[model samples]
Target: MSSTLYAAGRAARQSGDLQGLIDAVPYARFLGIRSAAPESSALLQLPFREGLVGNPALPAIHGGVTAAFMENAALLCLLLRLDVLRMPKSVDFAIDYLRSGRPLTLYADAEISRVGSRVAHVSVRCWQDQVQQPIALARGHFLLEPAPESA
Candidate 1:
């Protein structure tokens, strides 16, 4: 990731393309996660691919992948909301698997429950077709560091 991408994220209100920020992250790019705008809301979308399947028999996406996706979503949400450009470090993370993620497009939305000077708390939910029936849910605390002052 680069500072240029963080600049893009800060400019998203004008450009309306948050996907650039998401794509800047290497893991998100590897997972084929992109940003989707449905109506007036932005969401993280994970497309179905063969390589993401952890169980060939059941053909389900790996649990770790889902967790990582949720965590990334939370991070992206925080990045977009902050005024400064800096990467957040995960202080703690907890996830609950509601159902197996089948071979289908998954979408996630993150909510920032609380934000302090040095820490932020977020909750994320992932679902296939309906948001009400989430396949996985995650909550995490992230350390937010201020950007170095320009010299």
Candidate 2:
């Protein structure tokens, strides 16, 4: 609950400006994902754009694409938490595909579960326009390294 929003310029050294986020948004958009504002607590939303559709011959979005969105959301959460400061690395991630992400903007919300001294645990829930019904869930372990002692 001690989350704080960082403006475009003030965004954690990691999350860049809207334009930058927008430019970098490709990182998400490429995966069909985009992070929300109010950095304190954010969500990643991805539209079911035509180009991103896989096997349009089929009714469901590609599982790989959806999973990519989940990864972006979880990682961005860690970036926001560090005030864009520390650069943490993902040690491992576990994802559960609950349902198909269809006909809507897929989203992922990162929840801080625990912050140990060396690792931070984050939980992400992905839903397609509806928070109640989620398409997937993910949990990640990020390894944190302290900043080098400055002179």
Candidate 3:
């Protein structure tokens, strides 16, 4: 992990700094993903970019990019809720593409179904304008480990 991420994670752990947590991930930065603490849930935003389009004819965002965004959103949600500042490793990830993602700002939110001693399960949904109309849905299992004391 980058030192910048470490510091940002630390700051996020202490305060409810959603942006700090999002900035911790290099890929999140590249995707222009933003985090927000909504009244009810944690929300993730993905800004539209021409480079993200997979098919020029359809002008749709890549399925892989959408999946990655959903996964990262889940991880960020877990990090915010976790007591320890450690990186969670994905054990398994599954995504369902409901509809084609058009060239627009996308949003996502994660629901952590369960958290065991060593594993956590999360469900994520991504939408363009309305939450009812989702573009993709994802479920992921992650390995949770305690942070080193030396940190």
> Against the unseen true structure, what C-alpha lDDT does each candidate score?
0.83, 0.65, 0.83
Q: State the number of backbone clashes in model 3.
A: 0
lDDT of 3 at 10: 66
- RMSD, one per candidate, in order: 2.2, 5.5, 2.4
Q: How close is every model to the real structure, measured as TM-score?
A: 0.90, 0.74, 0.88
Separately for all candidates shown, the number of backbone clashes (residues 3 or more apart, or on different chains) is 0, 3, 0
Which lDDT tens digits does candidate 2 get at residues 7-46? 3313544444332343343465456455465434566677
| C-alpha lDDT of residue 53 in model 2 | 66
Model 1: residue 68 alpha-carbon error in angstroms: 1.0
Clashing pairs in 2: 12-83, 12-84, 13-84
Candidate 3 local lDDT, 4-107, one digit each (tens):
65566667767766787787787788888886554324698998999889998998999988988999998888877764456788999999999999999889
Q: Which stretches of candidate 3 lie over 4 Å from their true place?
A: 2-7, 37-41, 148-151
* Worst 10-residue lDDT window, candidate 1: 33-42
Residue 93 accuracy (lDDT) in model 3: 94
Q: On a 0 to 100 scale, what is the lDDT of residue 147 in model 1?
A: 56
